[model samples]
Target: MVGRTNIETGKVTRETALAAFSYRLKTAVAPLVPCAAAMERLHRGARHRILSKGDHILRAGTVADEVFFVHQGLLRYYFNDPNDGGQERTGQFFDEGIVVTDAESFLARVPAKQNFEALETSSIIVLPRTVLNAGYDADHAIDRFGRLMLEEALVGSQRRASRLLTLQPEDRYRLFVETRPEIARRVPQYLIASYLGLTPESLSRIRRRIAGQVG
Candidate 1:
Protein backbone atom coordinates (compact mmCIF):
# COMPACT_ATOMS: atom_id res chain seq x y z
CA MET A 1 0.00 0.00 0.00
CA VAL A 2 2.81 2.37 0.84
CA GLY A 3 4.60 1.69 -2.39
CA ARG A 4 1.43 2.29 -4.42
CA THR A 5 0.79 5.54 -2.60
CA ASN A 6 4.35 6.74 -3.03
CA ILE A 7 4.07 6.22 -6.76
CA GLU A 8 0.85 8.19 -6.88
CA THR A 9 2.33 10.94 -4.75
CA GLY A 10 5.28 11.29 -7.06
CA LYS A 11 2.93 12.00 -9.92
CA VAL A 12 1.24 14.91 -8.18
CA THR A 13 2.36 18.35 -9.36
CA ARG A 14 2.66 21.45 -7.19
CA GLU A 15 -0.42 23.02 -8.75
CA THR A 16 -2.50 19.89 -8.20
CA ALA A 17 -1.37 19.55 -4.60
CA LEU A 18 -2.15 23.20 -3.80
CA ALA A 19 -5.60 22.95 -5.32
CA ALA A 20 -6.45 19.88 -3.25
CA PHE A 21 -5.14 21.53 -0.12
CA SER A 22 -7.16 24.67 -0.80
CA TYR A 23 -10.34 22.64 -1.12
CA ARG A 24 -9.68 20.82 2.14
CA LEU A 25 -8.87 24.05 4.00
CA LYS A 26 -12.04 25.67 2.74
CA THR A 27 -14.11 22.67 3.71
CA ALA A 28 -12.69 22.66 7.21
CA VAL A 29 -13.50 26.34 7.82
CA ALA A 30 -16.91 26.23 6.13
CA PRO A 31 -18.93 25.77 9.32
CA LEU A 32 -17.24 28.73 10.95
CA VAL A 33 -17.92 32.37 10.08
CA PRO A 34 -16.65 33.04 6.61
CA CYS A 35 -13.79 35.50 6.51
CA ALA A 36 -12.24 35.89 3.09
CA ALA A 37 -9.25 37.80 4.41
CA ALA A 38 -8.51 35.13 7.00
CA MET A 39 -8.80 32.43 4.37
CA GLU A 40 -6.42 34.25 2.09
CA ARG A 41 -3.88 34.66 4.88
CA LEU A 42 -4.03 30.93 5.59
CA HIS A 43 -3.81 30.02 1.93
CA ARG A 44 -0.82 32.25 1.33
CA GLY A 45 1.54 30.43 3.68
CA ALA A 46 0.29 26.88 3.28
CA ARG A 47 2.29 24.42 1.21
CA HIS A 48 2.15 20.69 0.50
CA ARG A 49 4.55 18.01 1.61
CA ILE A 50 4.58 14.24 1.29
CA LEU A 51 5.89 11.63 3.68
CA SER A 52 6.57 7.99 2.97
CA LYS A 53 5.39 5.38 5.42
CA GLY A 54 7.57 5.26 8.55
CA ASP A 55 8.69 8.87 8.14
CA HIS A 56 8.75 11.01 11.27
CA ILE A 57 7.24 14.47 11.00
CA LEU A 58 7.90 15.40 14.60
CA ARG A 59 10.21 13.80 17.18
CA ALA A 60 10.71 13.91 20.91
CA GLY A 61 12.76 16.79 22.33
CA THR A 62 11.98 18.96 19.31
CA VAL A 63 9.66 21.95 19.27
CA ALA A 64 6.70 21.70 16.93
CA ASP A 65 7.22 24.80 14.80
CA GLU A 66 4.61 23.83 12.27
CA VAL A 67 1.10 22.41 12.24
CA PHE A 68 0.01 19.80 9.73
CA PHE A 69 -3.33 19.11 8.19
CA VAL A 70 -3.64 15.60 6.85
CA HIS A 71 -4.88 15.77 3.31
CA GLN A 72 -4.33 12.07 2.64
CA GLY A 73 -3.23 8.86 4.45
CA LEU A 74 -2.62 8.02 8.12
CA LEU A 75 -0.34 9.28 10.90
CA ARG A 76 0.40 7.93 14.38
CA TYR A 77 1.33 9.91 17.46
CA TYR A 78 3.30 7.89 20.01
CA PHE A 79 5.94 8.07 22.69
CA ASN A 80 8.51 5.81 24.23
CA ASP A 81 8.11 4.74 27.84
CA PRO A 82 11.39 4.71 29.77
CA ASN A 83 9.90 2.62 32.57
CA ASP A 84 8.79 0.00 30.09
CA GLY A 85 12.11 -0.61 28.31
CA GLY A 86 11.39 2.29 25.93
CA GLN A 87 8.41 0.49 24.50
CA GLU A 88 6.35 2.59 22.14
CA ARG A 89 2.83 3.44 23.24
CA THR A 90 0.42 4.72 20.63
CA GLY A 91 -1.49 7.82 21.79
CA GLN A 92 -3.51 8.86 18.77
CA PHE A 93 -4.07 8.39 15.06
CA PHE A 94 -4.75 11.18 12.56
CA ASP A 95 -6.44 10.30 9.31
CA GLU A 96 -7.48 12.44 6.36
CA GLY A 97 -9.09 15.80 7.19
CA ILE A 98 -7.66 15.88 10.73
CA VAL A 99 -5.17 18.40 12.06
CA VAL A 100 -1.91 17.06 13.51
CA THR A 101 0.29 18.81 16.05
CA ASP A 102 1.63 18.61 19.55
CA ALA A 103 -0.61 21.33 20.91
CA GLU A 104 1.06 21.78 24.28
CA SER A 105 4.52 21.83 22.80
CA PHE A 106 3.50 24.18 20.02
CA LEU A 107 1.69 26.58 22.32
CA ALA A 108 4.18 26.58 25.18
CA ARG A 109 7.31 26.65 22.99
CA VAL A 110 8.61 23.50 24.64
CA PRO A 111 10.14 20.37 23.26
CA ALA A 112 7.62 17.73 22.37
CA LYS A 113 7.45 14.53 24.41
CA GLN A 114 5.81 12.56 21.64
CA ASN A 115 6.51 11.84 17.98
CA PHE A 116 4.37 11.97 14.89
CA GLU A 117 5.03 9.33 12.18
CA ALA A 118 3.46 8.47 8.92
CA LEU A 119 1.79 5.06 8.98
CA GLU A 120 1.12 5.28 5.27
CA THR A 121 2.35 7.51 2.47
CA SER A 122 0.83 10.86 3.41
CA SER A 123 0.12 14.21 1.81
CA ILE A 124 -0.14 17.08 4.30
CA ILE A 125 -0.43 20.84 4.31
CA VAL A 126 2.24 22.51 6.36
CA LEU A 127 1.24 25.67 8.20
CA PRO A 128 3.99 27.52 9.93
CA ARG A 129 3.45 28.75 13.49
CA THR A 130 3.99 32.34 12.40
CA VAL A 131 1.18 32.14 9.88
CA LEU A 132 -1.25 30.66 12.39
CA ASN A 133 -0.37 33.20 15.04
CA ALA A 134 -0.78 36.04 12.62
CA GLY A 135 -4.16 34.74 11.58
CA TYR A 136 -5.28 34.56 15.20
CA ASP A 137 -4.37 38.22 15.78
CA ALA A 138 -5.81 39.41 12.50
CA ASP A 139 -9.18 37.69 12.32
CA HIS A 140 -11.82 36.77 14.88
CA ALA A 141 -13.02 33.78 12.87
CA ILE A 142 -9.50 32.44 12.59
CA ASP A 143 -8.99 32.87 16.31
CA ARG A 144 -12.22 30.97 16.96
CA PHE A 145 -11.09 28.18 14.63
CA GLY A 146 -7.81 27.82 16.49
CA ARG A 147 -9.56 27.73 19.85
CA LEU A 148 -12.02 25.07 18.69
CA MET A 149 -9.21 22.86 17.39
CA LEU A 150 -7.40 22.99 20.71
CA GLU A 151 -10.62 22.28 22.62
CA GLU A 152 -11.30 19.21 20.52
CA ALA A 153 -7.77 17.97 21.10
CA LEU A 154 -8.15 18.42 24.83
CA VAL A 155 -11.46 16.60 24.92
CA GLY A 156 -10.00 13.68 22.96
CA SER A 157 -7.06 13.38 25.32
CA GLN A 158 -9.30 13.40 28.36
CA ARG A 159 -11.61 10.77 26.88
CA ARG A 160 -8.70 8.45 26.06
CA ALA A 161 -7.25 8.84 29.54
CA SER A 162 -10.61 8.11 31.13
CA ARG A 163 -11.10 5.00 29.01
CA LEU A 164 -7.67 3.62 29.86
CA LEU A 165 -8.16 4.26 33.56
CA THR A 166 -11.67 2.88 33.87
CA LEU A 167 -12.28 0.36 31.11
CA GLN A 168 -11.13 -3.24 30.92
CA PRO A 169 -8.84 -4.14 28.02
CA GLU A 170 -11.52 -6.10 26.18
CA ASP A 171 -14.07 -3.36 26.75
CA ARG A 172 -11.63 -0.75 25.49
CA TYR A 173 -10.99 -2.71 22.35
CA ARG A 174 -14.69 -3.24 21.78
CA LEU A 175 -15.49 0.42 22.23
CA PHE A 176 -12.62 1.46 19.98
CA VAL A 177 -13.83 -0.85 17.26
CA GLU A 178 -17.40 0.31 17.63
CA THR A 179 -16.55 3.99 17.45
CA ARG A 180 -13.59 3.95 15.05
CA PRO A 181 -14.24 1.01 12.79
CA GLU A 182 -12.30 2.58 9.93
CA ILE A 183 -9.19 2.93 12.08
CA ALA A 184 -9.63 -0.59 13.43
CA ARG A 185 -9.66 -1.86 9.87
CA ARG A 186 -6.85 0.34 8.55
CA VAL A 187 -4.32 0.07 11.37
CA PRO A 188 -2.18 -2.97 12.13
CA GLN A 189 -3.43 -5.26 14.89
CA TYR A 190 -0.23 -4.90 16.91
CA LEU A 191 -0.38 -1.08 16.82
CA ILE A 192 -4.06 -1.16 17.76
CA ALA A 193 -3.16 -3.45 20.65
CA SER A 194 -0.56 -0.96 21.83
CA TYR A 195 -3.06 1.88 21.60
CA LEU A 196 -5.47 -0.12 23.79
CA GLY A 197 -2.73 -0.91 26.33
CA LEU A 198 -2.83 -4.64 25.59
CA THR A 199 -0.28 -7.18 24.54
CA PRO A 200 -0.79 -8.48 21.03
CA GLU A 201 -1.50 -11.96 22.39
CA SER A 202 -4.15 -10.61 24.72
CA LEU A 203 -5.75 -8.62 21.96
CA SER A 204 -5.82 -11.71 19.75
CA ARG A 205 -7.58 -13.67 22.44
CA ILE A 206 -10.14 -10.89 22.91
CA ARG A 207 -10.78 -10.79 19.17
CA ARG A 208 -11.27 -14.54 19.02
CA ARG A 209 -13.59 -14.42 21.97
CA ILE A 210 -15.67 -11.69 20.37
CA ALA A 211 -15.81 -13.58 17.09
CA GLY A 212 -16.92 -16.71 18.87
CA GLN A 213 -19.73 -14.84 20.56
CA VAL A 214 -20.86 -13.48 17.21
CA GLY A 215 -20.68 -16.86 15.48
Candidate 2:
Protein backbone atom coordinates (compact mmCIF):
# COMPACT_ATOMS: atom_id res chain seq x y z
CA MET A 1 0.00 0.00 0.00
CA VAL A 2 2.98 2.31 0.13
CA GLY A 3 5.94 3.56 -2.02
CA ARG A 4 7.30 5.69 -4.90
CA THR A 5 8.92 4.92 -8.27
CA ASN A 6 10.55 6.53 -11.33
CA ILE A 7 10.15 10.29 -10.93
CA GLU A 8 9.76 10.90 -14.67
CA THR A 9 6.64 8.74 -14.83
CA GLY A 10 5.03 10.69 -11.96
CA LYS A 11 3.28 7.52 -10.82
CA VAL A 12 3.64 5.40 -7.65
CA THR A 13 4.07 1.68 -7.40
CA ARG A 14 2.15 -0.32 -4.78
CA GLU A 15 5.31 -0.81 -2.73
CA THR A 16 6.10 2.90 -2.82
CA ALA A 17 2.62 3.91 -1.78
CA LEU A 18 2.58 1.46 1.08
CA ALA A 19 5.94 2.69 2.35
CA ALA A 20 4.82 6.30 2.26
CA PHE A 21 1.52 5.69 4.02
CA SER A 22 3.05 3.38 6.62
CA TYR A 23 5.69 5.97 7.40
CA ARG A 24 2.96 8.54 8.01
CA LEU A 25 1.00 6.27 10.37
CA LYS A 26 4.05 5.05 12.28
CA THR A 27 4.25 7.92 14.74
CA ALA A 28 0.61 7.48 15.71
CA VAL A 29 -0.01 3.76 15.25
CA ALA A 30 3.47 2.35 15.39
CA PRO A 31 3.49 -1.41 15.79
CA LEU A 32 0.67 -1.89 13.39
CA VAL A 33 2.68 -0.38 10.57
CA PRO A 34 5.06 -3.24 9.93
CA CYS A 35 5.47 -2.15 6.34
CA ALA A 36 3.54 -0.26 3.72
CA ALA A 37 1.80 -3.39 2.54
CA ALA A 38 0.87 -4.71 5.97
CA MET A 39 -0.36 -1.35 7.16
CA GLU A 40 -2.40 -0.88 4.01
CA ARG A 41 -4.00 -4.24 4.51
CA LEU A 42 -4.98 -3.29 8.01
CA HIS A 43 -6.19 0.14 6.91
CA ARG A 44 -8.50 -1.31 4.32
CA GLY A 45 -10.09 -3.39 7.06
CA ALA A 46 -10.12 -0.65 9.66
CA ARG A 47 -13.52 0.07 11.10
CA HIS A 48 -14.55 3.49 12.26
CA ARG A 49 -16.67 3.69 15.38
CA ILE A 50 -18.38 6.58 17.12
CA LEU A 51 -18.98 6.73 20.82
CA SER A 52 -21.20 9.17 22.63
CA LYS A 53 -20.34 10.64 25.96
CA GLY A 54 -20.63 8.06 28.79
CA ASP A 55 -20.55 5.09 26.42
CA HIS A 56 -18.29 2.29 27.51
CA ILE A 57 -15.91 0.94 24.88
CA LEU A 58 -14.88 -1.74 27.28
CA ARG A 59 -16.12 -2.89 30.69
CA ALA A 60 -14.65 -4.57 33.70
CA GLY A 61 -14.64 -8.37 33.58
CA THR A 62 -14.68 -8.48 29.79
CA VAL A 63 -11.95 -9.35 27.34
CA ALA A 64 -11.07 -6.61 24.88
CA ASP A 65 -10.29 -7.92 21.43
CA GLU A 66 -9.98 -4.46 20.00
CA VAL A 67 -7.79 -1.43 20.46
CA PHE A 68 -8.95 1.93 19.27
CA PHE A 69 -7.08 4.84 17.78
CA VAL A 70 -8.90 8.05 18.49
CA HIS A 71 -9.94 9.96 15.42
CA GLN A 72 -11.73 12.51 17.57
CA GLY A 73 -12.87 12.91 21.20
CA LEU A 74 -11.81 11.82 24.67
CA LEU A 75 -11.74 8.62 26.70
CA ARG A 76 -11.21 7.81 30.35
CA TYR A 77 -9.76 4.63 31.83
CA TYR A 78 -10.92 3.63 35.28
CA PHE A 79 -11.54 0.79 37.68
CA ASN A 80 -14.48 0.18 39.97
CA ASP A 81 -13.74 -0.22 43.63
CA PRO A 82 -16.18 -2.62 45.21
CA ASN A 83 -14.86 -1.67 48.60
CA ASP A 84 -15.89 1.90 47.86
CA GLY A 85 -19.42 0.81 46.94
CA GLY A 86 -18.61 0.66 43.23
CA GLN A 87 -16.95 4.03 43.01
CA GLU A 88 -14.86 4.49 39.88
CA ARG A 89 -11.24 5.39 40.37
CA THR A 90 -10.12 7.05 37.17
CA GLY A 91 -6.64 5.90 36.20
CA GLN A 92 -6.04 7.87 33.04
CA PHE A 93 -7.56 9.98 30.27
CA PHE A 94 -6.87 9.99 26.54
CA ASP A 95 -7.97 12.06 23.58
CA GLU A 96 -7.54 12.50 19.88
CA GLY A 97 -4.40 10.91 18.41
CA ILE A 98 -4.25 8.55 21.38
CA VAL A 99 -4.69 4.77 21.33
CA VAL A 100 -7.34 3.66 23.81
CA THR A 101 -7.57 0.03 24.85
CA ASP A 102 -7.46 -2.40 27.69
CA ALA A 103 -3.93 -3.53 26.84
CA GLU A 104 -3.89 -6.14 29.57
CA SER A 105 -6.97 -7.82 28.18
CA PHE A 106 -5.74 -7.60 24.63
CA LEU A 107 -2.35 -9.06 25.45
CA ALA A 108 -3.33 -11.69 27.98
CA ARG A 109 -6.65 -12.61 26.39
CA VAL A 110 -8.15 -12.34 29.85
CA PRO A 111 -10.90 -10.23 31.33
CA ALA A 112 -9.92 -6.67 32.06
CA LYS A 113 -10.33 -5.15 35.47
CA GLN A 114 -10.33 -1.68 33.93
CA ASN A 115 -13.09 0.09 32.07
CA PHE A 116 -12.63 2.25 28.97
CA GLU A 117 -15.36 4.83 28.58
CA ALA A 118 -15.94 7.79 26.38
CA LEU A 119 -15.63 11.10 28.24
CA GLU A 120 -16.91 13.00 25.23
CA THR A 121 -18.37 12.17 21.84
CA SER A 122 -15.56 10.31 20.08
CA SER A 123 -14.56 8.73 16.79
CA ILE A 124 -12.07 5.87 16.72
CA ILE A 125 -10.40 3.38 14.40
CA VAL A 126 -10.86 -0.09 15.74
CA LEU A 127 -8.07 -2.62 15.17
CA PRO A 128 -8.65 -6.21 16.07
CA ARG A 129 -5.89 -7.74 18.16
CA THR A 130 -6.29 -10.98 16.24
CA VAL A 131 -5.41 -9.28 12.99
CA LEU A 132 -2.48 -7.49 14.54
CA ASN A 133 -1.09 -10.66 16.01
CA ALA A 134 -1.46 -12.49 12.71
CA GLY A 135 0.44 -9.73 10.99
CA TYR A 136 3.14 -9.96 13.63
CA ASP A 137 3.53 -13.65 12.91
CA ALA A 138 3.81 -13.05 9.19
CA ASP A 139 6.31 -10.20 9.16
CA HIS A 140 9.50 -9.61 11.12
CA ALA A 141 9.01 -5.87 10.86
CA ILE A 142 5.54 -6.20 12.31
CA ASP A 143 6.94 -8.29 15.15
CA ARG A 144 9.45 -5.56 15.89
CA PHE A 145 6.64 -3.08 15.84
CA GLY A 146 4.79 -5.04 18.50
CA ARG A 147 7.88 -5.23 20.68
CA LEU A 148 8.57 -1.51 20.39
CA MET A 149 5.00 -0.68 21.24
CA LEU A 150 5.22 -2.78 24.38
CA GLU A 151 8.41 -1.02 25.38
CA GLU A 152 6.69 2.33 25.03
CA ALA A 153 3.74 1.08 27.01
CA LEU A 154 6.07 -0.05 29.80
CA VAL A 155 7.76 3.33 29.89
CA GLY A 156 4.39 5.02 30.25
CA SER A 157 3.44 2.73 33.11
CA GLN A 158 6.67 3.51 34.85
CA ARG A 159 6.07 7.24 34.49
CA ARG A 160 2.64 6.92 36.06
CA ALA A 161 4.07 4.92 38.93
CA SER A 162 6.74 7.55 39.47
CA ARG A 163 4.15 10.29 39.64
CA LEU A 164 1.96 8.43 42.12
CA LEU A 165 4.91 7.57 44.33
CA THR A 166 6.76 10.88 44.42
CA LEU A 167 4.46 13.76 43.56
CA GLN A 168 2.10 15.49 46.00
CA PRO A 169 -1.42 16.44 44.98
CA GLU A 170 -0.55 20.00 44.00
CA ASP A 171 2.58 18.99 42.17
CA ARG A 172 0.69 16.26 40.38
CA TYR A 173 -1.96 18.74 39.30
CA ARG A 174 0.70 21.06 37.95
CA LEU A 175 2.36 18.26 36.07
CA PHE A 176 -0.95 17.11 34.68
CA VAL A 177 -1.66 20.64 33.54
CA GLU A 178 1.67 20.86 31.82
CA THR A 179 1.52 17.48 30.14
CA ARG A 180 -2.17 16.87 29.57
CA PRO A 181 -3.69 20.32 29.36
CA GLU A 182 -6.57 19.11 27.21
CA ILE A 183 -7.61 16.64 29.91
CA ALA A 184 -7.50 19.25 32.64
CA ARG A 185 -9.46 21.65 30.47
CA ARG A 186 -12.13 19.21 29.32
CA VAL A 187 -12.66 16.52 31.93
CA PRO A 188 -14.80 16.95 35.05
CA GLN A 189 -12.98 18.14 38.15
CA TYR A 190 -13.99 15.11 40.21
CA LEU A 191 -12.75 12.67 37.58
CA ILE A 192 -9.53 14.59 37.37
CA ALA A 193 -9.27 14.39 41.14
CA SER A 194 -9.76 10.64 41.00
CA TYR A 195 -6.94 10.34 38.46
CA LEU A 196 -4.72 12.44 40.66
CA GLY A 197 -5.53 10.18 43.62
CA LEU A 198 -7.40 12.87 45.49
CA THR A 199 -10.95 13.57 46.57
CA PRO A 200 -12.84 16.33 44.82
CA GLU A 201 -12.45 18.58 47.90
CA SER A 202 -8.68 18.12 47.82
CA LEU A 203 -8.66 18.92 44.13
CA SER A 204 -10.50 22.17 44.81
CA ARG A 205 -7.80 23.24 47.23
CA ILE A 206 -5.12 22.40 44.71
CA ARG A 207 -6.90 24.38 42.03
CA ARG A 208 -7.44 27.42 44.30
CA ARG A 209 -3.81 27.33 45.36
CA ILE A 210 -2.71 27.23 41.78
CA ALA A 211 -4.96 30.18 41.02
CA GLY A 212 -3.52 32.12 44.00
CA GLN A 213 -7.09 32.24 45.30
CA VAL A 214 -7.01 29.80 48.20
CA GLY A 215 -7.74 31.44 51.54
Candidate 3:
Protein backbone atom coordinates (compact mmCIF):
# COMPACT_ATOMS: atom_id res chain seq x y z
CA MET A 1 0.00 0.00 0.00
CA VAL A 2 1.14 3.54 -0.75
CA GLY A 3 1.11 5.92 2.25
CA ARG A 4 2.21 9.50 1.66
CA THR A 5 -0.32 11.69 -0.06
CA ASN A 6 0.43 14.10 -2.85
CA ILE A 7 -1.52 17.28 -2.20
CA GLU A 8 -1.84 18.03 -5.87
CA THR A 9 -2.64 14.55 -7.22
CA GLY A 10 -5.06 13.46 -4.46
CA LYS A 11 -3.12 10.18 -4.30
CA VAL A 12 -1.81 8.54 -1.15
CA THR A 13 0.39 5.59 -0.31
CA ARG A 14 -1.90 3.24 1.60
CA GLU A 15 1.01 1.44 3.43
CA THR A 16 0.40 -2.03 1.99
CA ALA A 17 1.78 -1.18 -1.45
CA LEU A 18 4.84 -3.38 -1.59
CA ALA A 19 3.20 -6.28 0.20
CA ALA A 20 0.20 -6.06 -2.10
CA PHE A 21 2.47 -6.01 -5.12
CA SER A 22 4.25 -9.09 -3.87
CA TYR A 23 0.94 -10.86 -3.33
CA ARG A 24 -0.19 -10.06 -6.86
CA LEU A 25 3.15 -11.12 -8.36
CA LYS A 26 2.95 -14.43 -6.59
CA THR A 27 -0.40 -15.11 -8.24
CA ALA A 28 1.02 -14.04 -11.61
CA VAL A 29 2.35 -17.46 -12.61
CA ALA A 30 4.31 -16.05 -15.55
CA PRO A 31 5.90 -13.05 -13.84
CA LEU A 32 7.11 -15.18 -10.97
CA VAL A 33 8.90 -17.54 -13.33
CA PRO A 34 11.20 -14.73 -14.48
CA CYS A 35 14.77 -14.11 -13.32
CA ALA A 36 15.58 -12.03 -10.27
CA ALA A 37 16.70 -9.02 -12.32
CA ALA A 38 13.43 -9.03 -14.25
CA MET A 39 11.48 -9.09 -11.03
CA GLU A 40 13.46 -6.13 -9.77
CA ARG A 41 12.67 -4.24 -12.94
CA LEU A 42 8.97 -4.99 -12.49
CA HIS A 43 8.97 -3.68 -8.93
CA ARG A 44 10.70 -0.48 -10.00
CA GLY A 45 7.86 0.41 -12.37
CA ALA A 46 5.13 -0.33 -9.83
CA ARG A 47 3.42 2.65 -8.19
CA HIS A 48 0.63 2.23 -5.71
CA ARG A 49 -2.77 3.76 -6.35
CA ILE A 50 -5.75 3.95 -3.99
CA LEU A 51 -9.08 4.46 -5.65
CA SER A 52 -12.56 5.12 -4.33
CA LYS A 53 -15.62 3.18 -5.37
CA GLY A 54 -16.95 4.26 -8.79
CA ASP A 55 -13.62 5.66 -9.92
CA HIS A 56 -12.93 5.35 -13.59
CA ILE A 57 -9.61 3.58 -13.99
CA LEU A 58 -9.86 3.34 -17.75
CA ARG A 59 -12.46 5.05 -19.88
CA ALA A 60 -13.59 3.83 -23.25
CA GLY A 61 -11.84 5.30 -26.29
CA THR A 62 -8.88 6.52 -24.23
CA VAL A 63 -5.30 5.44 -24.77
CA ALA A 64 -4.32 2.40 -22.72
CA ASP A 65 -0.71 3.06 -21.81
CA GLU A 66 -0.45 0.97 -18.67
CA VAL A 67 -1.51 -2.27 -16.98
CA PHE A 68 -2.80 -2.50 -13.42
CA PHE A 69 -2.50 -5.32 -10.91
CA VAL A 70 -5.33 -5.36 -8.43
CA HIS A 71 -4.14 -5.28 -4.86
CA GLN A 72 -7.58 -5.16 -3.21
CA GLY A 73 -11.32 -4.78 -3.88
CA LEU A 74 -13.06 -5.45 -7.18
CA LEU A 75 -13.32 -3.86 -10.60
CA ARG A 76 -15.77 -4.26 -13.46
CA TYR A 77 -15.00 -3.79 -17.15
CA TYR A 78 -18.07 -2.53 -18.96
CA PHE A 79 -19.11 -0.93 -22.22
CA ASN A 80 -22.04 1.20 -23.32
CA ASP A 81 -24.21 0.68 -26.34
CA PRO A 82 -24.87 4.13 -27.70
CA ASN A 83 -27.29 2.95 -30.35
CA ASP A 84 -29.84 1.66 -27.85
CA GLY A 85 -30.06 4.55 -25.40
CA GLY A 86 -26.73 3.86 -23.68
CA GLN A 87 -27.33 0.41 -22.31
CA GLU A 88 -24.38 -0.93 -20.31
CA ARG A 89 -22.92 -4.41 -20.40
CA THR A 90 -20.21 -5.64 -18.06
CA GLY A 91 -17.61 -7.79 -19.78
CA GLN A 92 -15.27 -8.70 -16.94
CA PHE A 93 -14.74 -8.63 -13.19
CA PHE A 94 -11.29 -8.42 -11.60
CA ASP A 95 -10.50 -9.06 -7.96
CA GLU A 96 -7.39 -9.08 -5.80
CA GLY A 97 -4.34 -10.82 -7.25
CA ILE A 98 -5.74 -10.29 -10.71
CA VAL A 99 -4.53 -8.36 -13.75
CA VAL A 100 -7.07 -6.39 -15.77
CA THR A 101 -6.51 -4.77 -19.13
CA ASP A 102 -8.33 -3.94 -22.30
CA ALA A 103 -6.93 -6.78 -24.42
CA GLU A 104 -6.52 -5.35 -27.94
CA SER A 105 -5.74 -1.79 -26.89
CA PHE A 106 -3.07 -2.63 -24.31
CA LEU A 107 -1.13 -4.86 -26.67
CA ALA A 108 -1.75 -3.00 -29.91
CA ARG A 109 -0.85 0.36 -28.30
CA VAL A 110 -4.14 1.86 -29.37
CA PRO A 111 -7.04 3.59 -27.61
CA ALA A 112 -9.10 1.37 -25.34
CA LYS A 113 -12.53 0.44 -26.63
CA GLN A 114 -13.87 -0.47 -23.20
CA ASN A 115 -14.17 1.10 -19.77
CA PHE A 116 -12.92 -0.30 -16.48
CA GLU A 117 -14.34 1.00 -13.19
CA ALA A 118 -13.74 0.11 -9.61
CA LEU A 119 -16.73 -1.73 -8.16
CA GLU A 120 -15.51 -0.88 -4.70
CA THR A 121 -12.73 1.18 -3.12
CA SER A 122 -9.63 -0.50 -4.49
CA SER A 123 -5.85 -0.54 -4.39
CA ILE A 124 -3.58 -1.38 -7.31
CA ILE A 125 -0.06 -1.21 -8.67
CA VAL A 126 0.37 0.50 -12.00
CA LEU A 127 3.05 -0.35 -14.57
CA PRO A 128 3.28 1.79 -17.65
CA ARG A 129 3.61 0.23 -21.08
CA THR A 130 6.84 2.14 -21.70
CA VAL A 131 8.49 0.67 -18.61
CA LEU A 132 7.38 -2.85 -19.51
CA ASN A 133 8.63 -2.40 -23.06
CA ALA A 134 12.02 -1.22 -21.84
CA GLY A 135 12.25 -4.12 -19.43
CA TYR A 136 11.52 -6.53 -22.26
CA ASP A 137 14.28 -4.97 -24.33
CA ALA A 138 16.77 -5.27 -21.48
CA ASP A 139 16.17 -8.90 -20.49
CA HIS A 140 15.04 -12.12 -22.10
CA ALA A 141 13.45 -13.19 -18.83
CA ILE A 142 11.26 -10.12 -18.81
CA ASP A 143 10.26 -10.79 -22.42
CA ARG A 144 9.13 -14.25 -21.45
CA PHE A 145 7.14 -12.77 -18.59
CA GLY A 146 5.33 -10.48 -21.00
CA ARG A 147 4.57 -13.29 -23.43
CA LEU A 148 3.23 -15.55 -20.72
CA MET A 149 1.05 -12.80 -19.33
CA LEU A 150 -0.38 -12.19 -22.79
CA GLU A 151 -1.07 -15.86 -23.29
CA GLU A 152 -2.96 -16.04 -20.01
CA ALA A 153 -5.10 -13.09 -20.98
CA LEU A 154 -5.87 -14.64 -24.35
CA VAL A 155 -6.96 -17.89 -22.76
CA GLY A 156 -9.28 -16.10 -20.34
CA SER A 157 -10.89 -14.17 -23.18
CA GLN A 158 -11.48 -17.33 -25.11
CA ARG A 159 -13.15 -18.94 -22.13
CA ARG A 160 -15.51 -16.04 -21.69
CA ALA A 161 -16.31 -15.97 -25.41
CA SER A 162 -17.14 -19.65 -25.41
CA ARG A 163 -19.36 -19.31 -22.36
CA LEU A 164 -21.30 -16.44 -23.89
CA LEU A 165 -21.91 -18.40 -27.09
CA THR A 166 -22.67 -21.88 -25.81
CA LEU A 167 -23.92 -21.67 -22.22
CA GLN A 168 -27.40 -20.81 -21.03
CA PRO A 169 -27.65 -18.09 -18.37
CA GLU A 170 -28.14 -20.61 -15.55
CA ASP A 171 -25.19 -22.68 -16.73
CA ARG A 172 -23.09 -19.57 -17.04
CA TYR A 173 -23.93 -18.56 -13.47
CA ARG A 174 -23.05 -21.99 -12.17
CA LEU A 175 -19.78 -22.04 -14.11
CA PHE A 176 -18.96 -18.56 -12.82
CA VAL A 177 -19.43 -19.71 -9.23
CA GLU A 178 -17.36 -22.80 -9.91
CA THR A 179 -14.49 -20.78 -11.38
CA ARG A 180 -14.63 -17.54 -9.36
CA PRO A 181 -16.67 -18.05 -6.22
CA GLU A 182 -14.65 -15.42 -4.41
CA ILE A 183 -15.58 -12.83 -7.00
CA ALA A 184 -19.22 -13.86 -6.86
CA ARG A 185 -19.26 -13.24 -3.13
CA ARG A 186 -17.46 -9.91 -3.30
CA VAL A 187 -19.08 -8.28 -6.32
CA PRO A 188 -22.63 -6.91 -6.35
CA GLN A 189 -25.49 -9.07 -7.63
CA TYR A 190 -26.29 -6.66 -10.45
CA LEU A 191 -22.77 -6.82 -11.83
CA ILE A 192 -22.82 -10.59 -11.61
CA ALA A 193 -26.11 -10.60 -13.46
CA SER A 194 -24.63 -8.38 -16.15
CA TYR A 195 -21.60 -10.62 -16.47
CA LEU A 196 -23.88 -13.65 -16.86
CA GLY A 197 -25.99 -11.80 -19.46
CA LEU A 198 -29.14 -11.94 -17.32
CA THR A 199 -31.41 -9.45 -15.65
CA PRO A 200 -31.39 -9.25 -11.88
CA GLU A 201 -34.83 -10.83 -11.50
CA SER A 202 -33.83 -13.71 -13.75
CA LEU A 203 -30.70 -14.27 -11.71
CA SER A 204 -32.76 -14.21 -8.54
CA ARG A 205 -35.06 -16.85 -9.93
CA ILE A 206 -32.14 -18.98 -11.01
CA ARG A 207 -30.54 -18.64 -7.60
CA ARG A 208 -33.76 -19.71 -5.91
CA ARG A 209 -34.13 -22.68 -8.21
CA ILE A 210 -30.58 -23.80 -7.60
CA ALA A 211 -31.00 -23.38 -3.86
CA GLY A 212 -34.17 -25.49 -3.94
CA GLN A 213 -32.34 -28.26 -5.76
CA VAL A 214 -29.45 -28.16 -3.29
CA GLY A 215 -31.82 -28.16 -0.34
Alpha carbon deviation, residue 116, candidate 3 (Å): 1.0
Please provide TM-scores, in order, for all candidate models, with all chains considered together.
0.90, 0.81, 0.84
RMSD to true structure for each model, in Å: 3.4, 7.8, 4.4
Alpha-carbon deviation at 160 in model 3, angstroms: 0.6
lDDT of every model, 2 decimals: 0.83, 0.74, 0.78
lDDT for each residue of candidate 3 in 132-153, tens digit (9 for 90 to 100)? 8877887776666567677878
How displaced is residue 188 in candidate 2, in Å?
1.3
Q: Residue 86 of candidate 1: its Cα lDDT?
A: 100
TM-score pick, better of 1 and 2? 1
Q: Looking at model 1, which ten-residue stretch has the lowest summed lDDT?
A: 1-10
**Residue 146 of model 3: what lDDT?**
67
User: Any runs in candidate 3 off by more than 4 Å, and if so which?
Assistant: 1-15, 22-38
Stretches > 4 Å off in candidate 1:
1-32
Error of 3 at 86 (Å): 2.2
Alpha-carbon deviation at 212 in model 3, angstroms: 1.8
